[model samples]
Target chain A: MRLRCLALILFSLSSSLARTQPDIANPHSEDTNWLNQYAHGLGEQHTELGLEALQLGDYAKAERSLLDAIQVIKVNQGLYATDQLRPLQYLIEAQLTLGEWHAAETQIEYFQWINVRNYRNSIFTYLNGTEALSGLLLASSANVNNPYSVRHLVAAKNLNWQAVNAIEQTFGSNSLELAPWLYRIVLNHYYQSTMLRRQGLSNYSFKSDSSEIVSGWTMRHNETLEMSYRIGKELLGRIQELFAYHVADHEQISNDATALMTIYQGDWELLFGNDEEALEHYRSAYQDLLQMGRSEAQVDRFFDRPVSLPAPRLQMQWPDQLAAESNEPLQFFAWSPMYPSASRPAEPRGDALAADDQQTALARFDLTPAAEDEPADTILADTNLSLDNLQILGTTPDNELTREQARVYISLLQFRPRLVSGMPVKLENIELEYLFPPQMSLLPLLDP
Target chain B: MIRSVGAYLKIRGTEMFKAIFALLSILLLHACVGSPAQSNAPRLPTDAEVEQYNASVPADEHIVCRDEIPVGTNIPRRKCRYVRDIQQTSTFHREQLRRALQ
Candidate 1:
């Protein structure tokens, strides 16, 4: 009985030991070890080295290191199911700095995919808002309408509303979390306002006869000021966080923080209504540009070029004047009555009269009526006579009358003169009497 | 003493069998676990597998030629012989001739 009891105890002990010692062929062990090593290597001041490379303007090296870190994190996550999102964030920043927009977009998409795949549902709420803001800004800069831009704005608005709901549900109306929610609310309003402005619907009614409409429209203009203040406060908080940890150099981080502040301030002042403040910030940015040894032309091309506004006066006047100048000369003569044969011979007789008597008679004539008819003769005489002859004949009434009548007739002929080649006699006072041809009525065979 | 020795042998044999059974059971449990859990596990492709995969994939999808040839080089012309009969063939042929002359 004693031996059997001992054997039973021993067997139980042996089975427990066997269960505790997992199978040697287990695949998870090797993967876990690899993931640990990869995470350790990547976490060991990789960001510091990458930032240093960036400071030295070794962009290629920085990009390579950052990408390497991102790849390591990706592989590590695949093996161990651990979150390594910081490396991806750094990678995105590096890609942005390098102006690799496509790569940045791809990385952002990957980050979003990872978040969804890992069921980090709350992460999208924050990242979606941030990415949407960034996309909207980028789209505005490029002056392009794209799916990314529209989706981003929509996502941002939705996420912000979700965040608001979350905060309201969790903390109620009086919560300190409302502070961050306010920034998001402000952003949502600003984005809507700007979108409205872009679509030429700036005057739209958000509500009937409410100040909210005006406030909504003005929010885009006011956002720069609000954003500058917000960014400044955020920078201070970030600086305090950085200093509290002593993880990075305070001066360098402060400079970068302040640089971003200046960038936002400059952007606001320039885009909104603070040109003087913007100019100061721009000058400061320009100094940094100079320190970085960037060319003036490049800086100008990137940020400082003047926006082209619609020159209303030029837009209104230039085309009309150009059209007038480009056009065929006015066929004013085409509408005038044809000259009578009696009037043609009268013109030469009037030209033979003396100049002194014509001036005395012109002074007695009514000035306004005479002036109205003056252009009639002047146009005819100007068209036919040498400029010098026209000048001399202009002072004589008889000569002027004959010239005026001739001009009126010439103008009529030039506009739509009857082709009188078929009839040898010179017709006088030719006009369009009716729609149907007079000649067809006189001779019916002429219709064909 | 002989009985005691026999009992010890029997216990030892049973323990070995138990160890083998435990290992097999654990393996079977692992196999019962779905593909998604194992999908996270690392897989090192065998040389033969890799070679087969490479062979199965179209070459042009993976290979990109970016080297610039010197003017009047025959290498580009030689490459033209392998080009597929597509719309780009005539244009490629003309470019090859132009490059060869240049």
Candidate 2:
């Protein structure tokens, strides 16, 4: 009885062990173990193979292997969790290399979701933005073949704009802070804008160049000038403050202020219908450029003149803070030059000032043109001064009034047609030159 | 007395061995069986097969394949009947085999 009981216990134990140790001979049974091992083994194997393929420049094969690894991981693990992300990353690289941009984009979106759920890690966020930008650029360029496809261009522009906004918001606009990234975004935005302009989808408002000009010359205008003068004054004040802050070098600030002043003068002339005055301002700007040893010829070219007139002295006031250090007496001369012709009263009856004398005074010094009576109706009617008949008389060298003849003619048509209708008017011919103080130089002063 | 005692031991030991072996076999077989029946498999047509099928079909009917017909085509009920038959047979065969093995 004891032996039988021992044998019975032993038999049960043997059978239990046999059951636990799965039959290795049965292909079906072995297949379960094989599949488990095969899946895990294949995942690791393909990962290595995919990496090797990528290194070898076999992108298609790399994509297949990487995708296979990812699929296996997905099958084994219900969700593609963090551990499986490595394979997915490889998959993305492979797809990108193969130029499967759409597929890569879809995968990037999935990866972005994973990153969001994990926590908004900076690396993933940056990668997501980069990949999206790349995909958008690709789509935009591809749409060039189909120029009528507005959607692609619009989408590309919006995406690039979003990227720019995101970077700006995250890293303040300080170039030092975001210099490494700013260039690319800026270039992209510039190029995209150019493309959109070419496509006729641009929302460009035709802002008159005279707007900035008008704002700068507020000091010269009496009452007719708009709110621009106050704005200009405020801008000057801010510039002074900026100089105090050492944010800008002195010479740069000076040049910028001078340019603004020149623009203001140009705007004043445009509004007041005084081309001669606008030409004077432009000449002053050219002088400022000359004082800095910059080329003066470009100024003539800019105004379409054979020779540029000399610039007038800028009536720039020193900041009050600098007053204590200066021992020299302050001179508050008018920014404008006192022209001999301008001093003479307008006489409707007297013979007009000699054209030669007027020309000589204008040529020797920066002076304003004298006003004259309107010419007879025959001359006015013969001259193409009508609203329907406007003409751009060729530009004259060193003559601001001549440059603005067209605009003046237009204004005459609109506002003073009667004066121009039958008037035989002789415009005063003046040649002006700009003069700059020796202290004004392009190089900034070194701090003592 | 010894003879009767030995006989009792033998019978008891053999019976226990048989029961354990049967249990083990059943467990192993259960593990060997794979995923459940997949009877709803798609009957994808090959390109050449599709071409031949298309050629034999009448133009008025516009039958691309038995699986796909134009909305207005009055397809014979027998065509769809075959699709149902295929599905039913596959499901029945798999279930019957599973039941027999179990």
Worst 10 residues of 1 chain A by lDDT: A309-318
Model 1 Cα lDDT, one tens digit per residue, B11-73: 999999999999999987776553433666544442222222322233222111112355975
Top candidate by TM-score: 2
Chain A TM-score by candidate, in order: 0.30, 0.31
Interface RMSD of 1: 28.0
Q: Provide chain B's TM-score, model 1.
A: 0.32
Query: Ten residues in a row with the worst lDDT in model 2 chain A?
Result: A334-343
Model 1 per-residue lDDT tens digits across residues A229-280: 4433343233334332332543322233333334444543433344455546
Which digits, one per residue and each the tens of the lDDT, describe model 2 over residues A316-410? 32222312222232111111111100111112112212223222111211112122255322232123211232333333233555334323322
Q: lDDT of all predictions, in order shown?
A: 0.38, 0.39
Question: Which docking category, incorrect, acceptable, medium or high, applies to candidate 2?
Answer: incorrect
